[model samples]
Target: MIRDYSQRLVVQEVAPRDGLQIEQKWVETDDKIALIDNLSACGFTRIEAGSFVSPKAIPALRDGDEVFHRIGRRPGVIYVALIPNVKGAERALAAHADELNLVMSASETHNRANMRMSCEQSLAGFGDIVRLVAGSGASLNATVATAFGCPFEGRIDEDRVASIVDTYREMGMQGITLADTTGMANPRQVARIVERVLGRIPAEALTLHFHNTRGLGLANVLAAYEAGARRFDASLGGLGGCPFAPGASGNICTEDLVAMCEELSIPTGIDLLKLIELSRTLPALVGHDVPGQVAKAGRNCDLHPVPAYVRTI
Candidate 1:
């Protein structure tokens, strides 16, 4: 049963953009479209269709615009595209994305290595993207990468993240997402920083993006939820790793996260069984065992009726 006063948690499906970006074999455009359509059919209201980045940077996602154009858009569903710079933003707008997600790293070293720019330069570049999407009839979200900690520069300062969050709001961003790019977040840190961030920014506008590098993804998420964050960014099947961050693992598994939410009576509004089935297909496509637990062990509600002979025991 749904909780009477449960806060609605929005899951932004990041499989296409974050999930496939790390694959060795390029996922065919048709396959990508089918994945998006299948996810849409499963009642995912927000699907990140693709990213508009330099093919030189991420070769697997070279056809971002084509993917966005080919996807069948549902009335209430949002198709988000990751735009790295102004050029990428232009491409996303031309393809008619429902939302633009602009990303930047909080760690200066990671920022330089990842985007070839400093933290300040990245924020300045975001201003240009903000200008580009100001009148395009689409929502723009600013994602502060490495918000928790960075592999290149460990333990990012909370004040810096809060400063960026304040800056994003000043730039007219409707929402802000804190990305644990290297999966270094812990529950205690999540609660403490989120408590401070929420003091300035309203809880509804904040989203949490976690990675499972050290296997603390769900713990960090629960901490954030308790801190009043309602939006989450999850990749289907636990696919995706930061290209710039060495030793970083894939994203938080959608099925596992959904199962946790449902068990907690948090009202995530996702079908866990369908999500687990969707996760099974990913291991073969990507050629590895994803870190999702729900696919391995069925959800709590998945009970098999005992056979007549077994019932005698």
Candidate 2:
């Protein structure tokens, strides 16, 4: 397939929220703020800075309010906060979040497991959030989790996903994200689903969220991009996983994604070198090694010196 090298892709950095949420070690509020600020300086137009969920449910990001209020806001960057219900929406709005992301799994089984509620119940709650955020200048985005395939349900029907997308649009969502919650998506599946979603909404309004669980995250990304997806959600150092979904892994690594885009000549407007520098600091911050490859192996442009033995030979 012929690729467009001139295409510009929009990448939303989700490390501060998705990456830190599942961490056993609590990422300090100050550190989270600093991380967001640093990411803002890295030319990202959108960053999922934090989530305004229950402290008991996600204690790692319990400081969401403080993180949103204290972070240094950049002029063009939109700081996003994930909202689970009207209460979370209220908290996010009170903290002056630029965008509120609402999520619901497409699979009935997964939704019940992840949210402890049915899909209809989640939608009802979203309606309340929409009313609450109306006239508040904050945009709303609906995410369909497990859109590709579910861990418990196996293959998901495409018609079911389309119906969900239709509902999100009817509910006045400005943006929508199709999440591969457990990385069960393949390239063909990604292309097919992305094409169908784009038929319902413009590519600008759609974001593809993938996990690296089966090592197909980047492959699915390329397929989606080729099928007309322009926006993506990636976590730094490949940090993050679904606390509710079994066998889920980190997101497609921010540095690795940007590196691939750079090599393909696709414009992401993100500084790969800057992302690499930030990724290098993640292991110490999170208390473990990360899954990102570019940070460890360096970019393709990063060359090494010749060995003396090679010169002698």
Candidate 3:
């Protein structure tokens, strides 16, 4: 089968929430708002602005409400808030989040470790959240963490992932994300599962989230894209990981993904230069250098003048 590679891709920025959640240093609420404001102008249609979980659970995003309220909302940008349960969903709704993202692990062990609940219990809680957010003018996005593989369980079944997507669809969630929580997904596996999931859900309604723990993040992304997935989630400077998931590391970098898309002539509708500049600010925010590579390696078009000795030679 001939694969079409000319589709425009949606890059959803998850820096504010996912990127900073595990940072030990505190990023001021004002700085978070500033970052969002800057990103709002960079042509992203969706940005995961913050999470509404308890401060004790995720102290880095404790000021989520303030950040959401103060940031300038671009007209076309959908500001999203990650919610853990019904209470977080309520807070996200009250804070005027454009979209509420609910998460659960595909693996039972991972779910218990991450959410302290069984997969069934988490889905039951989501039932109440779906009812509460119904007709509230806010869209819901369901994320299946450890969808590709689990650190504790090693390999996950594709049938289990499909069943979870079915449950989310039955609950009236049109937006769904398959998260490579521990970065254990490879290109072939990603393509297979993505193709399988696309059989049950529309490609437009699905998003792929990948981590670079095993150095296959971008490869997995390419595989999914070939399998008809167009939307993806990436963090600035490759900053992200689950506190509860062992071996989980940084997400695929935003600028790196944009660079790859640019090289392949895939339209991402994002300003690569602006995204790079934004990524450069992460080192100071976290009090150390970030894991992203684009900031250090200039674009392919960047050229340096030849040295006098080299010219003579």
Instruction: Output the number of the TM-score-best candidate.
Output: 2
Backbone clashes, each candidate: 0, 0, 0
Cα-based lDDT for every prediction: 0.86, 0.92, 0.91
TM-score of 3: 0.97
lDDT of 3 by residue, 161-274 (tens): 999999999999979999998888999999999999999999989999999887888998899999899999999889886554445457998889999999888999999998
Candidate 2: pairs in clash = none
Which residue window of length 10 is worst by lDDT in model 2?
241-250
RMSD of each: 2.6, 1.3, 1.5
| TM-score, cand. 1 | 0.93
Query: Can you give the lDDT of residue 35 in candidate 1?
Result: 89
Flag regions of model 2 displaced more than 4 Å. 242-248
Task: Quote each prediction's TM-score.
Answer: 0.93, 0.98, 0.97
Instruction: Give candidate 3 misplaced runs (Cα > 4 Å).
Output: 1-3, 242-249
Q: What digit string (tens of lDDT, one per residue) describes model 2 on residues 1-313?
A: 6677688989999999999998999788889998999999889999999999999999999999999999998999999999899999999999999999999999999999999999989999999998999999999999999999998999999999999999999999999999999888999999999999898999989999999988899999999999999999999999987554445466999989999999899999998899899999999999988889999999888899988899777
Residue 169, model 3, lDDT: 96
